[model samples]
Target: MKITVMTADEQFITLDVDPEESVENVKALLEVETRVSLQQQQLLFNGKEMRNAERLSSVGVRDNDLVMMVLHTSAPSSRAPTNDLSFHPDGSAINPGAFQQHVRRDSDMMAQLLQRDPALAQAILGSDLNGLQNLLRERHQQRLELRRQQEEEMALMYADPFDVESQKKIEAAIRQKGIDENWAAALEYNPEAFARVIMLYVDMEVNGVPLKAFVDSGAQSTIISKSCAERCGLLRLLDQRYKGIAHGVGQTEILGRIHVAPIKIGNIFYPCSFMVLDAPNMEFLFGLDMLRKHQCIIDLKENVLRVGGGEVSVPFLQEKDIPTHFLDESRYSKQGSLGPGSLPESSGAKEKNDNMPTGSRSSGTTLSDPTRGPEFEAKIAKLVDLGFGREAVIQALSLFNGNEEQAAGFLFGG
Candidate 1:
């Protein structure tokens, strides 16, 4: 019977074979024709895989049927027979143990035997035992060389005081490694230690109540603790069905989201949305989505979170007013000029102070102030004319402290 065989690379070949022949016979012929070993040939018929022991007629294979063949390069196992051991070089019966010992001790005899049969040489080279030993030795040498180079480079990076960029790179790498190791160790030993470490927390207001929120750039969606949401009356704003599941470190929970929840950071307000989850003893988490939308910048080294970087200096809460709640007491002691008590409450509340001069207070009046209704409306209209959503423009205006220039900066920052 004649059949057509198609290869994975879209090559085709026509072959004539007996209908009663086993699939192994077809594989042997394919190996001779295509140089693909019988063990590496994967045959498929009618979209189903074919086994070597299966007979062509038993599998419903008919004349002119099409079969697909895929070739792989996996080495044969060590225990697999590579060559016939029935005859010796002197045409005598070969003993397996004596042959192995002779091949091990007599390199000249091994070479002469391999030279006589090229197939045996090819089989030995393609065996897993030879390949695995070479691969393992190469990997070990590469790793040792890599480790030595890293040690030398690190020594130079630390010894050379003038190489600032290298020093910075090394320090950043070490810091990231330390953070990963410490976080893993903490999770293993004291899972609750995460709550006490508040290096990324920022003071903000939900609705009108003061609250602390964590800035998590890695998170895809902003999250509000259920307790915090309840306290701020944000639970009442939940309009969407709580069908989504949130995955965390060691837990997964159903989450409810509140759209357009008013959040105030410093003196600016942002109409942000948050997924509400039942996180105990933890504050709100502002994710990358909200941070990117607001063009927020977190500068840990300077210890200041700045928004709207250019000419129009937006209203910002003094660093002193922001609290440091890190578990590491050393950070508390290292708090330089930006301590909580450094700025007077009156100075920090300059825009809201009732005792300020009339001219000064009028100049500081923002869109958030109820007295600037007409001006706020005009600013919103102008921003909407610039192709921004009314709600988004209003939020941006509040986030920029009512400064039209700063609001425009925020919108176009991306």
Candidate 2:
């Protein structure tokens, strides 16, 4: 079979040989044909370094196929080469263009060599073949040494910790880890410790009455204050059968639930159901149920609440625009302890105990009703001093007929 061999200098050598011929035999033939020594010739077929024992047919070589030849630096031959392009006689300058094309053919190797040894660029440009070859050899050896050191380090990493050599590395690694952890901890700041974030609220209208709706995904059911419901004309729609206690960070009396109400958000009215709680501070809460039913997405990235699967986006109220009452942490801090009295009475909504029997009164009513004896006043003061809200203490006392133990139990959710 006839095959062509392309030299690094782009010279072609056509040879007729057997398909079963070994790669070493082919190199010997190339040496005789090109006058280059066999030891200096490196054979590559299809970009793979061919083994000496690999046959032409076994290496996937066929008729008319091309193999590449790379010549490396070696001792001078006894007989001077006549037509070899890589070698020059008596310090003759190599062809700069041919040398550049040869190096550029393997872009990765050329880049690595240039990065490791910047002077390689000058050598290539100067057409100094011997100098370029020496620089490449030095860089290659340095790379091999670096690889050997890395392999040794990796081996040591898994070696016995009790070994004398490994002890220093282990100690150094532990010290480095501690230093890194300390640095990270020093740079980390907890926002809750130094600052408070404003609650998320959006402008919404319920039954023609405008109100701020607190967007709380953490709330399982949507809720609205009884006063807000009455203001929005939704009080008439409340189903008293759903009357129960609403439990969260604190427990509150749920008067009833509004079965259905239209809440207008950004010109779009969405049907929303609300559990009517006697809460005084927050007028409305947009909870998870409505969020999921409406396909709402709380996009913190854009700082907006996306409704109807992103069809509409409503921006939350800014800090300056948000009501100061909602931003007061101290009011909420005494939540469960204060009971109904914990709620502000600025609005005209009746106290939570308004529905209770005439004989019982909430703390708010007890405080104003001078007819109550001094003994009742002392009991209320005692419970209030114990961190229980005055209204809650009075209600508890009423439920237990003024028995402090039972009332304390009731106050603690017993």
Writing each residue's lDDT as its tens digit, candidate 1 over 218-288 gives 55557777788889988888744543333221122434568787887777777898866655534476776
Structural similarity to truth (TM-score) of each candidate: 0.30, 0.38
Model 1 residue runs over 4 Å out of place are 1-198, 309-414
lDDT of 2 by residue, 1-414 (tens): 889898777766677778987887787666535546666788998899898788999999999999999986864553323333343332222443454554455454355446644687667656666776565556446544655765555666898978986888777667767976864674475223223345588999998899888887755567789999999998989877666554322456878778798999888999999978877766888877899999999998899999999888899989898787876544553453112212212111123444445564334321232114687678889779768888777665543334565555455542
Tally clashing residue pairs in candidate 2: 1
What local lDDT does model 2 show for residue 386? Answer: 61
Candidate 1 collision pairs: none
Global lDDT of each candidate: 0.56, 0.66
